[model samples]
Target chain A: MAFEDKLSMILTIGILTSSALMLIGIAAILIQGGAAGHSIKSLIAANTTVNTRTLTLQDAFSGLSGITAIYLGIMVLASLPVLTVAALLTRYIGRKDNLFIAISATVLFDMLVAIFLIPYLLH
Target chain B: MLLLLLVAAGVLAGFIGAITGLGGGVVVVPFLALYLGVPIAYATGTSLISTIATSTGSARSYIKERIANMHIGVSLEIGTTLGAITGSLIAAEVYALHLQYIIYILFGLVLFGSSYFSIRKLKMKNFVPGKADWSTKLFRLNGSFIDEATKKKINYHGRRWLLGLAIMFIAGMLSGLLGIGSGVLKVLAMDSAMTLPIKVTTTTSDFMIGVTAATSSGIYWERGFLQPLLIAPVVLGVLVGARLGSKYLVKLNSRVVRYLFIVVLIVLGSQMLLRGLGVF
Candidate 1:
């Protein structure tokens, strides 16, 4: 299969999924982003005034506290495109290169580094 | 309440950002620092990681389109990858310590500049053939992408290998230093300088940023900045959001989106600068 043809079929599924749920997903994300933005703003204000309280160790981890909830919510949205486009492209290209495979490897490399470093940085 | 809100911000940023190629940074970063209580450095690093995820996710579409031009993307990346290593080192040694404000200002400026370039492209003529620069002509940098709108082949003569390589170098530096994906610069190089249509430029630029970020993420990991738990979900969000956004982009009014993108960049840039300088 030519790359273009393969892509068309895969995108059909993607377009369907996106059309079905884009708005709902968008709304959910908006609310989440607004909250994170607001919390940090208040913290900055509180910290600056009177120089009363410096940021604590827990302060750093606060950003990721919401990661799981936000991640899961967004993952459904993310999966749609990857499945649609990637599948489509695979069909179109006929020959698959190791490009994405390399990317997956690099991502793993990134994860491993993070795994080691986050602990050291926090301490 | 605040934590709940931050979670919401992450999700929303993911939602709108993928469409805009922002990956929730413009919205999430400011909100994290000003509203959610996250520190600026933490916010910046997190935003950078998410931006890479968004780009990686979106690469699927570009690959599908074949506009990503993997040959060009991978080749020019040599420069971008090198630039990333250098910039990260500089940021850690010099900017991270004594001249923090300088770093903020520089990154903010890069943002505004790239935004302006994007906006300028919106006003530029649609795919009029321009004479390729001598450099582009030499390397056969000129190629065309299918303009789905006009349903016509848009051909151009422009600087290819060197121009992209140079632009990627600058883009990589900013990516490492300030935490932006620098797709804006990469896109501008192709759109304005190389004369590719916006879709090709945008998609290819997104295609390229992943590798650039990968380089930095490695160092950031070894030096201990990456947090798997923190990055995992965000990457998940970014991938999904960017993929959807890229797919739907074919339907949206890109001119309108371009302006919106510029405005967001300006807003984010100013916010970061002010906060970093303690003027916020």
Candidate 2:
């Protein structure tokens, strides 16, 4: 397959898998009366105030089997773009396209800074 | 039930966004914040996540159809990503100062501004680039795509990379600050300033938005705005809707999409403005 085809395949697969996980997690949450001990009503309330500050990574991982499946699903969704960019980088490297490599690298660097460095700097 | 509501809204937003190549963040933010009573911050966070899903999902078909110009998209991302970081930092400051109303107001203005331009440019004529300069030759900013509407092969090249880069920087900053895909601004930059075809511009912007949104999302996550329960359904709904929407885009007339976009922008813009002014 060509590069664009491969890239599209990667994106489709990533989105489909993550979306399925999220759907399962959301269904579980609704059926199980919410995740991490919150009731479904509270969890789904229009004005509910759940956020990253209120929810921890550890909390998300621990509750996936029980209630944190949604968090895990979102985690997958968030990471997929970065993964796709990485795929682009690898493709460029194989083709020896310096311009694309630089471009993809810069974007990846920006993503990394946001993911790891920014949070560390803030706290 | 509320989760279901979110999914339903996401579906509508995604459908419109994918067909128009606007990425749906524009709709999701206003729908959630103004209509659904979700806090604006959370609405933006959820919208950004959904933006990623829609962009990524729709981008697949756009790429396959060869409507997206990867050269242009990748070249422009450098400015956007850097601008996103700067914008997110500024956003953090704005949020800290409890001046989130500014975001609301700015969002309204951007929507209005872009809608006006889109409406003006809604004439179904294809844009013709005048000449390729040094920047075009340096970047090799040329490609071809089959226009589904005309069913003709459209050969195109973009020029004025400097202007496009500058506009994209602003677009990125807006994306980060407002937690939107900022596809309107990006498309305007490419379509008008860089003189790329509207279809190519829109699809390339769609292809580019996911990276920009993802870059800013990390900050959103750390800031405690990314709520998983809120995002899960939006992501799922948007991805599915965008896929369906992209399929239909091939058959739909460009003018029809622009008209719909104009209506959505005006309604959402007015509402956000009212909310910002405390009129509602």
Best by lDDT: 2
User: What is the lDDT, from 0 to 100, of the residue B85 in candidate 1?
Assistant: 68
Q: Model 1 chain B, poorest ten-residue lDDT window?
A: B224-233
Q: Candidate 2's fnat?
A: 0.79
The digit string of per-residue lDDT tens for model 1 on B37-137 reads 65455555556666655665566566767766654455456566667666666665653466766656775677678787776667665566556565664
Model 2 C-alpha lDDT per residue in residues B18-65, reported as the tens digit of each score: 987788998899888887888878888898889889889888888877
lDDT tens per residue, model 2, A82-121: 8878887898899999988988898888888987899878
Runs off by more than 4 Å, candidate 2: none
TM-score of each: 0.66, 0.96
Best by TM-score: 2
Position A44, candidate 2: lDDT: 76
Q: Please state the CAPRI-style docking class of candidate 1.
A: incorrect
Query: Worst lDDT window (10 residues) for model 1 chain A?
Result: A44-53
